[model samples]
Target: MTEFADNVRQAAVAMRALFPATPMQRNAHLSAKYDADIWLKREDLSPVRSYKLRGAFNAMSKRIAENPDQQLFVCASAGNHAQGVAFVCNRLDRKGVIFMPVTTPQQKIDKTKVFGGEHIEVRLVGDYFDDCLRAAQEFCAAEGGQFLPPFDDPDVIEGQATVTMEILDQMPRVPDRIILPVGGGGLSAGARAYLNALNADVHLNFVEPKGGASLTAALEAREPVTLNKVDTFVDGAAVARIGANTFSVLSDTAPQDVLLATEDGVCTTILEMLNIEGIVLEPAGALSIKVLDDLRDEIRGQTVVCVSSGGNFDFERLPEVKERAQRYLGLKKYFILRLPQRPGALKDFLGMLGPDDDIARFEYLKKSARNFGSVLIGIETKSASNFERLFGLMEEAGFVFNDITDDETLVNFVI
Candidate 1:
């Protein structure tokens, strides 16, 4: 344990040449809301706007120190990891070949190029990440270049532990609990390793996106397993499988300590942080904060730290984030309505809505019959109970409708 702690401290000190430690900030708004001493490890403020660069830099720096001849680095990533590697490659003066899926957004691609500058090359490969990863591994082997894994490596884990090092140093006293966002588990694993080594009495909470609870799945199975499906909305942490190396460190995590935040729930947190707190957090960055509602009772009066992992949110997705958040809060809904073909029927149905209710979308799916037609409608209201009152009135008036807001399949196709 002492040896591991020493290694982490040494790694953190070595990182000073590249960049200083990220800040740990106490959030007054969250502290007041949760009745706890809420602190945020602002990894979102890092040079790459994420903690990923820590692992990437640690892995690359150590690799070169051990083998000076290793001049070329390779990695496959569509988002933060790619940018991390690019930044590190340029800083370390090493050649980097980054493979990204062809479908990756141009914004991310351009960011990677800007960070790497003349030190790296970008290759757009298959439409999926897995395909790009295979191509990168093959190319690395063929060219005899070292492949830098985003996570799942010893040096990377050591690098990520530096985050915990900074948190402990910045805080006036040891926190009662630390809340971490889990993706492929590198950050959590590293933090867990460091805390366990010191025999800290701190409680740990692991937050995962509900759609990609790979860490929960791994803990249940006692090993890493690939999920059959994953929701990519929280792309930063939407991993299909927990890394095997990381699982070894996190295997003993209690099920209760692993909280799952729904995609809509995360969006709600993102919006709240943006609108109320003036903080822009990416979906994955909001996971730890989103789970605070679940810990409202447990965390009261306790000093807790929530890691805001990244702030690489694209403003173009704001409308979608607002939409999901509205749906989650029950302020918005989509439904299929059976409206009478008669002209007065349309006017009467519109009148049925409460004053607070406003129509956002109205489209005809198809005229099912001469007397009746199916219309897709989206409504935004001030309160959730308004929907219940609105539905009751519709039933009484014989205005048939089906709420498709919660129907995933129907939403994917029609809404």
Candidate 2:
């Protein structure tokens, strides 16, 4: 075995001492839909409901073995990584200090606490992740404790490689393609390294949220670059910058292998997996699956594996997820219509509705002129083509309207 493969195998063996390998199940629903043999490496079933715990455990275990006198561990994270570190602290009976942004959801903080119990102390340090990370690093330096990075460390990368080791062992043969979600790139880098060492014939596809395409941006720049802004809707994988160490391993990857998934697009996949397969996936977890539509032609009849990285979804976000899915599917839209100030104006507009059209919202914006008034309307329809027909009717009837469904600025203020 190559050195990387040996390290991955060692990580896998070390993992078994803590918890059983996560399932690599063939997803019948996705396989039939995509016309391919689709498998999900279910990292969502890990003890921390994420593959992150593997890296944290592997890194800490190796460190402890080398120096048994080391007693303190420190890490900073907003979600999965925090839980992973906390879990390892509890498992190893070691004291750990975790720094998280004050803006972190209560659900995540609670889960981290549950996993760490008395072994970990969570410090709400700053409003932004970067600030919390700084605080954690300072604390680690002051206390002379080992700092456990979420993805930048080599040991953590080696730990994450264990997932690929399990995938190969569970499958009958090497998969034709493997899809991975990239955050700071720990899992992607590790898995890619191990798989490349084991079988050069396998195709690797990397998925990143469009709003936070750090990996894609880095690949284009030929180095890791920090994004000016990032949409944190997919919090689990929304990283503004890729880790320097993780990027080194992924730098040689071809640009064509990277795919970007929009937040709304990912929401659609999340809802589909929940409704159709009874699977609950966080936005990050759904990243790989969301890109299946884009890979339909290439993966047909071929064996493919998509890693469902985490299920750390907050139930409170369900409503927002549903809203995003509807918007992406074209089942919902918002518009500002100019209505004539005639007695039968409302009735004339209602007559244009298709059989499947439903008015979800309606409001009068203002009387821009004596002859007309601006109406804010939200419509839901059965099919996307329905909008074209509706628009034609509006044009023929001399009704003026503006579609604000995708206007982020306007929707944020008025919708």
Candidate 3:
């Protein structure tokens, strides 16, 4: 363990040539919210706005040092990892090929290009990430290039440990608890291993997106298993399968501490941090903060550290994030109201709305019968309880309504 710690320290020293240690600043908002000492390791402030660059740089550097003639590095990623690999390849003056799904956002592709400049080539392959992975690997093998695994590789995991090294160096003392967001599990495994290796008195808490609870599934089966379905709302931390190597390291941690956070819960945190703290966080970056309410009992009076992993958030998705948060908080709702095709009928329904309620959407579906029409109405209010009152008023006024906000299938079909 100590030997591994020494190696991680060496990696930290080497990383200084690229960028200084990421900050570990005490967060007053979180500390006050939980009545506990809370510090955040701001990996989001890294050159690539993520810790992924550490792994990509470390693995690539070691490989090149061993074989000077090996100049090609290849990877498949649609998000932060792509940017990370691109940034490192350009920084090290090595050639790289980054393959991303065809559906990947243009903002991300542009950012990756900006990072790689002339040192890398960006390839758009299949529509799905798995397809992109297959294409990337086949291309790498055919071209005799080194394939950089995003998280599963040993060297990559070792490099991610540098985060923990920085944490221990920056903080005044060892934290009583460390909250980590897990996707493929690289960051969590690396940070946990380093903390345990250093004999730090820290209880590790792993948080996964509820839609992609790969680590939770692995811990339950006592081994890694693939999830049949996963929601990609929290794209940064949503993985259908946890890496075998990562699960091997995580198997020793308390399974109960692995928290599966709702995507909406993470959205809530994202919006809260943005509005309340003036902090911009991507969905996955807010995972640790989202689960703090669940850990309130365990974390009170204890020093805690939450790693804000990445901030490469595209503003294009901000509307979706806001929508999800509103739905989760009951502040916004969509309903189908059956109204009689009469002028006073519409006026009566409008009068049912409370003073705080504002109509955000109004679409006439169609006339269902001789005297009734189906109208899709969206309402937004300052407080959640306003909806309850509005519903009661609608019911008392003899209007029939169906809430389709939480109905996934109906929403896709109608809304």
Candidate 4:
């Protein structure tokens, strides 16, 4: 363990040649709100806009160290990991082949291309990451290329542990707790290794997207297990299966320490940081910060650190983020209304709305019936209870309505 700590520190020193340590900023807003000294480890500000570079760089460097003649590398990633590998490959002047899913955003593909220049070749393979992973592995084996496991390799883990070294060096005192966002678990695993070796009394909590809690599921089962389904909205942190190597280090974690942040709630946190603090956090990056609310009572008067994992968010998804946040906050909703085919019928329904209620969408879905029509309506309100009051008035006025805000099928198809 001591040797591992020493290695992590050495890795931190090596990282300086690439880029300086990412900032650990004390957030005044969060500190005041929680009555805790809150600091954010801004990995989002790294050269690749994520801590992924640390692991990739370390793994590649170690491989080069083992075989000086080795020059080829391969990886599979939809986002940050690809950029990390690309960045390292460019810096090391090595040839790289990155396999990505067909559905990966073009911005990421272009950015990876820009980072790697002529040294990296990107192949768009499957519709999902698993397919890309298989393809990359097959290609790497056939071409005699060293394959980089994003979070599962020991050298990568050692590289990621450098973040902990930087935190201890940057902080005035050891933090009371460290919160990390977990996906395939490399970052959390690496942090755990170095921090545990230091024998600090700090509490460590791992946050996972509620839709894809690979770590929590592993802990609950006492072994790593693949999730049957995963929500990819929090794309960077949504892993269907925790890496076996990472789970080995994290298996002893208490289930209670694995906090889950909802996809919608993550959108809210992203918006909060963006709007209030002007910090544009990717959904995966916001995971650690999003779950801070759950730890407020315990962390009071204590120092806390949240790892902002990445800032590679696409502005094209901004409207979707805003929509999810609004839905989660109960400020927006959609419903189907049965309206009579008569003049002033729409006016009467509009008249029933409270002063704070605003119609965001109103369209007749169908007018096939002779007596009434199906109207798709979207409403925005100042508060959640406004909908309740509006519904009561709607009921009294003999208006038939179906609240389809929470209906997945209807929302996907109509709203």
**Stretches of candidate 3 exceeding 4 Å from the true structure:** none
Q: For residues 1-415, write the lDDT of model 3, one tens digit per residue.
A: 5987888888888889999999998999999999999998899999999899999988998899899999999999999999999999998999999999999999999999999999999999999999999999999889999999999987888999999888878889878888889999999889988987988888889999999999999988999999999999888988999999988999977888999899887888998988998878888999998899999998999999999999988888888889889889999999999998887999998888888899999999999998999999999999999988989988988899999999989876765
Best by lDDT: 1
Better of 2 and 4 by TM-score: 4
lDDT of 1 by residue, 1-415 (tens): 5988999899889878888888889999999999999999999999898999999998998899899999999999999999999999999999999999999999999999999999999999999999999999999989998998888998899889999988998999999999989999999999999999899888999999999999999989999999999999999999999998999999999999999999998999999999888998999999999999999999999999999999999999999899999999999999999999987998998888999999999999898998999999999999999999999999999999999999989988876
Instruction: Please report how far candidate 2 places residue 252 from its true position, in Å.
Output: 1.1
Q: Give Cα-based local distance difference scores for all models.
A: 0.94, 0.93, 0.91, 0.93
TM-score per model over all chains: 0.99, 0.97, 0.98, 0.98
Q: How many backbone clashes does candidate 2 have?
A: 0
Error of 4 at 234 (Å): 0.4
Superposed Cα deviation of residue 281, candidate 2 (Å):
0.4
Question: Model 2 over residues 1-415: C-alpha lDDT tens digits?
Answer: 8998998788788788789999999999999999999999999999898999998998999899999999999999999999999999998999999999999999999999999999999999999999999999999989999999999899999999888788888998888888989999999999888877876578889999999999999988999999999999999899999999999999998988999999999999999999999899999999999999999999999999999999988989999899889989999999999999999989999999999999989999899999999999999998999999999999999999999999989988887
Candidate 4 per-residue lDDT over residues 1-415, each given as its tens digit = 5999988888888889999999999999999989999999999999999999999999999999999999999999999999999999999999999999999999999999998999999999999888999999999889999999999888999999898888889999999899999999999999888878988787899999999998988888888899999999999999999999999999989888999999999999999999999999999999999888999899999999999999999999999999899999999999999999999999999998999999999999898589999999999999999998999999999999999988878898987
**Could you give me the TM-score of model 2 versus the true structure?**
0.97
Worst 10-residue lDDT window, candidate 1: 14-23
Candidate 3 has an lDDT of 0.91
In TM-score terms, candidate 4 sits at 0.98
